[model samples]
Target: MPDATQDAAARILAAVRAIPRGQVAGYGEVARRAGLPGRARLAARVLSQNTDRTLPWHRVLRADGRIAFPEGSAGYREQCQRLRAEGVAVVDGRVRRELMAGAHGDLDAMVWGPPPR
Candidate 1:
């Protein structure tokens, strides 16, 4: 991969690491936190190739607050289990909006420092 791509992936990983145990962020939100607006797909792609299992990969989700894994699949079950274990309500495969109320809808600030809001 190009240096830019590698750098972006590193940034995304850093942002993923910053997500608190009980909080989750959409892929788009993570991309924004990585300083790459409108690059949600890039974040997902980076996650697919992620080797650092220590990163909170499961805390990243679709923009609609849905887990990307197919429902009923092992990955899906794992994602749901991991999220619920973090106290993030996973209802019908979608995380509760109440838990995401403090979300960062804009990309003007560094989201990884303070909790997104």
Candidate 2:
């Protein structure tokens, strides 16, 4: 049987794997989906130690839709490139919230910000 750590990692990995291509999820969101709310740091840790080259780790981002890597870093550039290849609009290292995976709120409001008076 897997230990608690292993189980948590498994669940987190599964949650990450479930994020569809051309979409993205926040680290906190991934943790919540994996039944480990408030474990966003754990999610990032697991991804950092990931050995599976096939895992779509780049699909996970900060809650505010920003890439976690420092700007101008190789990781940052690669992440941006990967997301753009999937048709996701990335601007200044920030992804549009409307393009985030599982987003179900008001599309117009999210895409265009608050409506004009």
Candidate 3:
């Protein structure tokens, strides 16, 4: 039987994995979706302790759609690079609001890979 920590980590990781490619969700939203509402810090903590390189950690951002890493940090640069590789526009270290997972017309962008221009 898994301990509570393991269970929580599993739920958190699963929620993170559910975020589709080229899309991003806030830490709070991920926590909410993981059945652990109001535990955004737990989500961040679990992610910080993760060892799997395959996890899409870059797809998670702050509530305001900003990168959580400090500016000029390696993590911040890596996150910006990863997001841009997925066709997500990262301006001044923040994902464009219209491109966030729950934003308006996000379904169209997610399904069709953003409109040209």
Model 1 C-alpha lDDT per residue in residues 1-117, reported as the tens digit of each score: 999988999999998888878877888888888899899899999999998878889988887788999999998999999999988899999997645523544333334456645
**Which 10 consecutive positions of candidate 2 have the poorest summed lDDT?**
102-111
State the weakest 10-residue window (summed lDDT) of model 1. Answer: 101-110
1 or 3: which has the higher lDDT?
3
- Tens-place lDDT digits, model 2, residues 1-117: 459999999999998898878878999888988999999999999999999999999999998899999999999999999999988899999999877744754322344577566
Give the C-alpha lDDT of model 1.
0.82
Residue pairs with colliding backbones in model 1 are: none
- Checking candidate 2 for backbone clashes, the offending pairs are none
Q: Determine which window of 10 residues in candidate 3 has minimal summed lDDT.
A: 102-111
For every model shown, the clashing-pair count is 0, 0, 0
Full-model lDDT for every candidate: 0.82, 0.87, 0.87
Model 2, position 8: C-alpha lDDT score: 98
lDDT string, candidate 3, 1-117, tens digits: 469879988999998998888889888878887889899999999999999999999999998899999999999999999999999999999998866765764333566685666
What are the models' TM-scores? 0.84, 0.85, 0.85
